[model samples]
Target: MKFKNLLLSWKYPSILLLGIGISNFGAWVYFIALNLIVLDLTNSALAVAGLYIVKPIAALFTNVWAGSVIDRINKRNLMVALDLFRAVFIALLPLTSSIWVIYSVVFVINMAGAMFGTTSRSYITKLIPIEQRKRFNSLRSLIDSGAFLVGPAIAGILFLIGTPILAIYINAVALFLSGIITLFMPNLEKDRSLEQSDSSLSWKIIKQDWAIVLNFSRQYSYIMFMHFLFSCMMVMATAIDSQEAAFAKAVLFLTDTDYGFLVSIAGAGIIVGALVNTMIVSKIQISFLIGLGSLFVSVGYIIYSFSSSFSIAALGFFIIAFSLAFANTGYQTFYQNNIPVEIMGRVGSVFGLLEACLIIITTTIVGVSAQFISIQFVVITGSIIMFALTILLFILSMKPSKSRYYSVKSVEAKDL
Candidate 1:
């Protein structure tokens, strides 16, 4: 089907796609601009890392309640409110010169985002037909990748034209526009018959559903463990990129524009990977694809650690971006396929919580490690660990029970 025609035929799905795409574009712009602002203000790597750390930490604490709220509330309204809240927060960011205020605002923005994100994923399952999930996810990834490809570059240009503060204002306006679009989009009513009739909002639902959650948790334990390992590797590996940018500036005597161009090229790699996933991944066993992707990512990081030249480093970044695209797409599809639609929000939120916790812990560890050891050593060690986990995940994915769940054929044929 033609992409535009596909979207037109699927109205709610189309709205979700557009709203998320626009919002993500704004968010990425804010993210890069905020980091630059922080760095300029503090001139300290630790301060910048701390700003990055706040969101995940906040999500770790608030995700459970957010999940519960998503389960009980109107998903569309929740997302609109969250978007508006984020817009206000972004608008306020430039007004504050205090580091602590920035940290607090970042935490709040992320907390709101976690809530919206869980609901959004669940809503997508409800809105999009099951047979079209692979395509839907591919489209989502493309939008996200496209945003990443353009947002930072735009932010950089805006910063050059005016200031980081002006970029922040633009982000706020974009977010506001996204929220307004969401408000007009069709509201997807939940399957009330599938849920309890009780008006009481207690922890009882979670308590009763604990067994099911535990069962699924046990079944996917290896995937969860691998996620933790991958999270650690990502935290360390990403830190290396930040350090490398500084090193490149100092050693290679590269201009800021050169660094920006290289970063945009890496983003372009992500766009390529997303396009590939959209076109080809539906034909493969998702488990095998995820394992292969992880292996590639680990190899990329390992090579990156040893790279001496800018071209070599850029190649490594390209591979990492490519692998991450496939791996993340495979993993998200696996979750949506396996989990029941009714409990999808809660399940996704729980997973998000776990992911946030792992990221926070890993980022802290890596940030500290960077202070002592070389970024190269950290990247190399993290890559080894990630490689080991990928191997373990591959073995686990081959098991009969796990293999069934991760198979693209099974996912397409089976109902959630």
Candidate 2:
């Protein structure tokens, strides 16, 4: 479907897309300012790194039972509440000069973010039809990439005009605006029957919800395995990302402006890829979309790991970012289509918890390994691991996935 046609077909989806885009802008701006604050406060690279870990740590705890709460509540309300919650905390951030208080506020905001993510996905799955998910996801990818690209540039301008504190205040205002926009979207409350039957919103239900998710997992091993592989991809990507600036400057001898140009090209690549996907996604099989995109991204990173020239490295960045749009859209479509709609919140929270923990664990291992091993060797290993995993997933896609709820063959036959 054409992008214009897609937008015209839905009212709430467009609103949601615009809201999320704005939210992402706020998030990226806040992230940049927060990292700067940490570095300025402690004058320690380790402390800044420590601050990065705070989100994952908070997710590890919040995601354990977030599904329980998400399933029982109004998703729209939850999203708005989370946005307002985050806005309040973020607005309060500049009031304190204490590094510890900043950390505490950041952690709370991150927790709200984690819950928002799982709940929003569940809400989207319910609101958007299965056939249109690929398109919606592609649009989301486009907005997210565009937001990341624009947000930092805007933040930098704010810093130039005033201070990083000004950027934080701007983000808080953005969050507030996002919340107000969300209030205008379609009011999609859960089915009254489902909500009535669902367990009450309480901590005691967390254990029960987890058991439900575990049983659900056993019934759908293929889905869980794919999720695990995706987790690995995420971890490897994070590991490579952590060392990206260092490799770009220290190893490739690129100047700061050169690295900035490379990043801009990568962002442009993502937008281009998403644009292309919107045009071609309806004709492509999702398994091919995912498997081939994964292969493409892995190959790009492998090229990056070995490249000695700026031009070649820039090509790697383009390839990775471009294919990443496809991979992300494919995975999101797969996730939304296969999972039972009612249990989406619970299963998603479980997956989030697992992915968040794995990311931290893998990143820590890579960081420590870099201390003794050659950084180049560590990076190459991550690239190879990504390649191997993608290759395995591609091989597995030779036949239809074992998922009872959705199949690659069904995806092809339905033309969705």
Q: Largest lDDT belongs to which candidate?
A: 2
Residue lDDT tens for model 1, 262-374: 67767878999999988996786777666677778877877666677778777877898887777776666766666666666666677677777766666567556756875
Q: After superposition, how far is residue 199 of candidate 2 from its true place, in Å?
A: 3.7
Cα shift from native, residue 307, model 1 (Å): 2.5
lDDT tens digits, residue span 1-416, model 2:
69988667787888999899999998888889988977888898888888889989999989887888787778887888889999999999999989889889889988998999998898898788777788888889889888878899898998899888889999999999899998897677745332453556766778888888887778767767776787688779998898888788777988999999988889888888888887888888778777788889999999999989988988999999899988888888888877776778888888888888888888888888877786778888999999999888666644554434335322221221
State model 2's lDDT: 0.83
**lDDT of the structure predicted as candidate 1:** 0.73
| Per-candidate TM-score against the hidden true structure | 0.84, 0.92
- As a whole number from 0 to 100, the lDDT of residue 275 in candidate 2 is 85
Off by over 4 Å in 2: 1-8, 190-198, 201-204, 401-416
Q: Model 1, stretches more than 4 Å misplaced? A: 1-8, 39-45, 190-212, 219-262, 398-401, 407-416
